[model samples]
Target chain A: MAKFKKSALKENDGISAPETTSIAAISKIKEKRRQKKSTSDLVKAILNGNITALSQAITLVESKNSEHLEQANAIIKACLPHANKSVRIGITGVPGVGKSTFIESFGSYLTNIGKKVAVLAVDPSSSITKGSILGDKTRMEDLVKDKNAFIRPSPSGTSLGGVARKTRESIILCEAAGFDTIIIETVGVGQSETAVHSMVDFFLLLKLAGAGDELQGIKRGIIEMADAIAINKADGKNLKQAKLAKVEFNRALHLYPVKTSNWQPKVMTCSAIENEGIEAIYSMILEYKKLTIDNNYFYSKRNQQNKFWLIQTIEEQLKNDFFTNSKIKIELEQQLELIENNKTTPFVAAEYLLGLKT
Target chain B: MAKFKKSALKENDGISAPETTSIAAISKIKEKRRQKKSTSDLVKAILNGNITALSQAITLVESKNSEHLEQANAIIKACLPHANKSVRIGITGVPGVGKSTFIESFGSYLTNIGKKVAVLAVDPSSSITKGSILGDKTRMEDLVKDKNAFIRPSPSGTSLGGVARKTRESIILCEAAGFDTIIIETVGVGQSETAVHSMVDFFLLLKLAGAGDELQGIKRGIIEMADAIAINKADGKNLKQAKLAKVEFNRALHLYPVKTSNWQPKVMTCSAIENEGIEAIYSMILEYKKLTIDNNYFYSKRNQQNKFWLIQTIEEQLKNDFFTNSKIKIELEQQLELIENNKTTPFVAAEYLLGLKT
Candidate 1:
């Protein structure tokens, strides 16, 4: 309804290249192009410390498409030589335990100390809950903005095995991209902790003081797997309870047999929110690393972990091949019914099924 | 020698058909015949509560000959309908924890109460140690001599899986032979406890009093799986220590999350040597059985166990076939070396090997 400029009406304004639209959409397209790079190119870029290339390579590794499998393998194979140089630490705690905040604070501290930190998660429940943990970058606001840190959500998959495999491969890529410190986070609710434990050099469990029934909610065998336990929220009125909890945990941990590493598991108090006691935790880790390296347990443990993954992957695939067979699937249900009716023993049923496979 | 009776060596004294020599060897041959019965005949004999046939069937189950596989399967299938009628109890303890004595006392108690008892063992180490456990039935002398009790030594196998399978099948034969109570014993040192736990209706851990560290010698997760812990050697001066251990263990047990069985695990003190507290243990088992049955956990747990075994057998065979493959064995070593040198990720290596298999 207002006055129009006469020059605009003249139509001589030669279609000024459709005003560069949606920067976010363009960047996403760019990302896709980056991820579609040749396997060798991606590996070369990753080895040169290119974060975008590292992320792209991880996407390829996590891809369910059959076509991506070979490329992903090639990238991992090429990147393998540059990997194994990082200090891989696994962090685990139950849901309301402020895992994101802990990782953010801990990760920032590592970066401040001139370390390149890469954070990844293994949440088996993510597939069902559509990534309930680490899915939102907002949860780690400062770390997300930190140029020296890389944050990634849990990979979505139908099974924990699939997700764990992807995360492990991504660790290699991150390490190749010059990530000196890798933090793997997992919810301490299921078998995901075991997978994470097998992949990390050290495991840290976070706990809150005065949760009532200190050990009641802990999963079985978790304490045995931890290299250290940090009683978080050790500030304000909670400080005394946290210190007491630390002593109790220390006592309980000693009840376990001495670890083969000859390093005793330790317990300490920390405030991930207030960022208190963070340096001490890192110092403790450095001490542990020094001791383990001196004792040769560090290298030996990595070798053992690699061997475990090799066997685990083979077994998982073997199971997938067998259980997914159409005929076997149909026959399995029938055998289960037979088991229910007590018409067949499980061993006999298994033998029959195995014969059917052949 | 000159004083021997003339009838002993007379060739034609009374035209005696060569006096039968070596009565022991002749009886052994008769025992062999009893073991080699046809599948249907063995099933019928087992169903008719014939202990000899039950033992023979168990031997067939334990045999390594491929020819016996089909026969064993048939016997198990025939026995299936009559199985699952007994209360299967698993007992485990360290070597010096009086496992045999406890079984002798408790098993005798069951038989004396008009309950037919069958004792079997799963000691994977037995194959290597020539069965340090149960191999010598002389350990359970009184129970062995009881007509109502049948004691079978641990079946020896190179793998725990194989030994566990044999013991599981033997349970079927024993149940079909009218054994209303089955007692499975295992050395508490290895994975045998887990194997035993999967198959039993109740798991009882035997522990000595005042072992200095009440929980130190326990393998990880063993206490979590126990339905009850009996602090043995509670007689004499050890009584006070055993009571203290009971209190300590009870406190530790409460720290664990309630079991899915909805029944809290119990800790008690007993003296196997003095034949004290044996009745209390039996009462505890009875109480557990009643609760589980009333809540329907007993039936559900059995079903889950059957399914577990079925899958376990299939997976074990799958691994066996893969590892034993000539090509895979050669490639596996190469891949392992590649892993050592960090030339390939385990996932990538596993994929290449799996591809080669096809």
Candidate 2:
């Protein structure tokens, strides 16, 4: 370790002939080494299914500090080769649809069946200035206590894009730690569902029984994105209504154009509290996985998602940098004012604001 | 005209003196004067509702010649003050859903009510190397012959964005030429429907009656964008099924979340050849217009759309510029290969390709 450190420092000295042996610089190098060694240890531990290391690595990934982000990147780089072995599933539901309870039930069932399950969340709305639905952390008590079940709450206070980036990287860490089934839970109301859907192999939406489907949050775009719908809380008095909803949801799904995946989205009923039909939903996911794998869509879809995220991240960061430029911000505001007053068409205004000739 | 031309050319003399009266320069000035006089005359004639001038201006807007583009820009700038007076409606349907025939029937109804109508096509599919669906021209025979109606076919062989830009500018020209009602038609299968939806005050979709509603072309996103649906070909034995389809559609729409406009989209059945329900559909548009305008949503929605298009146009162009760059293309392909091989995560790969130390 000392020899390697000396060689690395000497290479830096070769670039800049400053202070390879100075006390101040030496202390800084020692501090960096301490942080780096911990990150390396974390990766090693995580690969051995050490849950504590997994949690610490995730905390680093979710940290807003620059130093933590660098170390998190290093840990993620080491974990990448060990990831992508899990079947990722995204689950979403409205606030009252019992997503947490369902996940707890579902997670416990998977663990009982000898599957190591990791449950993560992408909830940007927790950052909303209004009251956030504090549902994930407190609702999954059983899963939190299970040795084979891991539950992580959504990272608080960030944009959906930021939260998505963190949770997605954390997925790699979880997978590297040997979790075979990964579930990404999101609230159906926000743009987070789209982000979750992009990273998951199967997307499931949970809905309540009855005409409550008319709730103002479940948009057609979300419904169309679902690979399956589980009508939750379908025990006892609500059983008939839940069955009816399943039929209606099936018909509604049929009205949609055929999905590109060629997999017809199924609707099922499950009472997470009663532990009814939870096994059926898992079976459905396995069926979808088997079907997609047979057709090579599993690998192809992952490849497409990787490319999608690559371009999306690049474009989004580029846009952020451009928009945050002080000059661009002032000019953009002026152009928007011009458009509002009808001085120019939006396209012409954009061209002008972008420094192109009129 | 001669006096203005001489003075305009002489402004160059105010800056430089050498070529003020040279024969070659004088002849070129005269040639420019001839073109400028005709463009000004074309604008004058269009403002007087001359169909021939209207046709010529649209041709210029659709042209690829650099000189024609400059003139088109000048014409569009001049026409802007006289535009934005029309209620622009976007109509979309599958190729066989009888969009042109419905427009023909609807246009004739409007013309009979003393409203001048202009129908414009946005068909990017013609650019496909496969045989184009040339249905617009021949399907609207009656409207083509009507004095108060102007039917312009799609600008052939361009992208959806290019075609949208052309059709949007053409609507301005048509509005300036006294067309109080403009119908922008798009085939629903492609991304053109979104483009059409962006520019129009109201969006109408035409659907056929049958199980073919599950056809892969009609994406749910497009359906969600519709402000109204007219089930066409309700004249024959399809009438009963069409009525049933309307009820089903209304119910299906209810299952989706409410739109921000706060105006519930309406569905109605219509028969183009029989002219059944044509006027009722028009009445629905007026009612929607009244409600939205009363609730102040119409203005707000239009503003939102303008802002959306401005940002969308800029981002898409920026992406095109970046992806088309020689350096970025090669680097992007390499990063994609790395991602496909699981050597690096997409976000990290993107960062490296973008020149960041990941």
Candidate 3:
């Protein structure tokens, strides 16, 4: 992870008067291009897979600069036809589960076999610091240099689910760009994991050899969602424990009814550091894909996930809008204080705040 | 629990009109109520503490019937001024933990001490099967017989968390009605438990001894949220394992950071069947409340819960609105079939659906 000095990318500089005017000019040019370009132009670009335009378009969607949102929507509409061809995989584990390392090894194996890979991180922690170690780009030196590999770090935002509103938009951009495998790396475990799982085609849970406490911390609801569990760091003395965990997870997976796809979930072990068993992990995913496809689960799962994202996105936006209202904000603090002082209950405070907005 | 046949409730036939018209009337009534009723009017009624009105108001809030919602909102607004005086306690356990039996015995103890108690269940099961069980009010026969105590089986026809919402609202109405304590019984051992915990002052997790696989199924997130753990059925040959599980859970709890509240979470043993150690559990909750109040955490926690509920309610409403959109629904089903056929991916389908709406 490349740690950029604060001096390197001054945040305030982007909005300086001269820069602002240039940005305005660029915005005008973008607007003209948007007005003139047919959807076919955009689709062709996406199909020929122009990476820079795709990235720029994704940035536009993520941008708080409202001016860019329209353009972003247009670009996405144009690219939609060529998108949704890839297998979107979501991987999660606790901090020490070696998520990055596993992704690096696993991603490398896929690319080595001529598959184009795109690795994205969903880091909720990035929201506070706005500085993420994984997003630094320099961390995955090998993957970054590979012709078939694409690595994008978490976007800086408040949403814990890695990526952003545009991440889903970007997945289409990636698929359109000819990247057949999109791996979403979420900050290990918690609510954010659920966010990632909801959007992906396949869900992989990475676990350590002895995550007894972790196993307890992860809710059964989440466990039932995983399509496969891979015990990572299964080397040296921990191998036995990893195997044992695999057995335990396998048994736990059985308690759930057969999946809609009619395919049994699988558990495996791998050592990301050693790069051993990575291929087997890939094969397992392939087997799952095959089973799901044959059972007609692949398309249905994707459709459900799509519906989930659309609703999720709208819900998130509505929440943001509700909280951001100036009138609501002014009353919220006072109401919260009232609730704290026992002068009012939460139900009452909420009613009052909502009343103010309406 | 009383299992009144469906035939019995059907006799109240005229009450079964479609909710739209009634909901509209209730909404207007609620608005007029907000404008006219003084806090005293709301409180006076609650201090008289009518259980039927409280139950009806909660029903209004839970029902899709617009008219009832208006009245429910009005009642809640009026009751708001008098709510939150009681200690709200949340209890959850895996299925087969003898939850109903424990509540029956424990509730009887509270009433014996001259404390008016209200027990509400948040049913997580499906709505079709729920009404049958909703009639099973005979489970807590003793508590039901006690004029000072109220036992409400789970409210039927809502989402897993929906039941909790109704339960939380009911707690407010119960408190207004002068109940000294409100015990929320969860749907058991999963996401619903978290929903229950977020709304209460103290959270209790109940468990059975030697429930090996059952214990493993308990989500760690719920365990971490717990303020106390009780090993139910701790009175017989199972005593040894219950004690052992207590040790294990105690150690597990230690791994979590000390809760923000002053009290160190406690682990205890109880036999609901034998009616042993019931009072101790109540005392522990009282002690927790006292400690949190002394440390100034009582009001703060309530404030946080209020904020959480406000945001949660809005989000749920927003999602419901989005999914219920007629255009989105038609497009969604078509896209879902395409996805099932593997002709398109979720990302692409989402983009298409979102595009259609825009």
Candidate 2 true-interface contact recovery: 0.63
Q: Compare the candidates by TM-score and give the number of the best one.
A: 1
- Residues B1-358 of candidate 1 have per-residue lDDT tens digits of 8667657656645665665688888899999977666899989999999988888788888888877877888888888889899999999988888999899889888888899999999888886456658867787899999999999988878899988999998998899899989999999647889999999999999998766767776887888889999999899999989998999899889888899999999998888878899999999999999999999999999999999999999999999999899999999999999899998888878888999887
TM-score of 1: 0.89
As a whole number from 0 to 100, the lDDT of residue B218 in candidate 1 is: 80
lDDT for each residue of candidate 3 in B32-66, tens digit (9 for 90 to 100): 97773433454465668766556656666678786
On residues A260-348, what C-alpha lDDT tens digit does candidate 2 reach at each position?
67789999999999999999999999999999999889989989888889989989876776677788788888888876776667777
TM-score for chain B of all predictions: 0.89, 0.84, 0.79
Q: What ranking emerges by lDDT with the best candidate at the front? A: 1, 2, 3
What lDDT does model 2 reach?
0.83
Give stretches of model 2 more than 4 Å off: A1-37, A128-136, A211-217, A254-262, A356-358, B1-38, B127-136, B211-218, B253-262, B356-358
Question: What digit string (tens of lDDT, one per residue) describes model 2 on residues B241-301?
Answer: 8988888788777766778878799889999989999999999999988988899988777
> Highest DockQ among the candidates is held by which one?
1
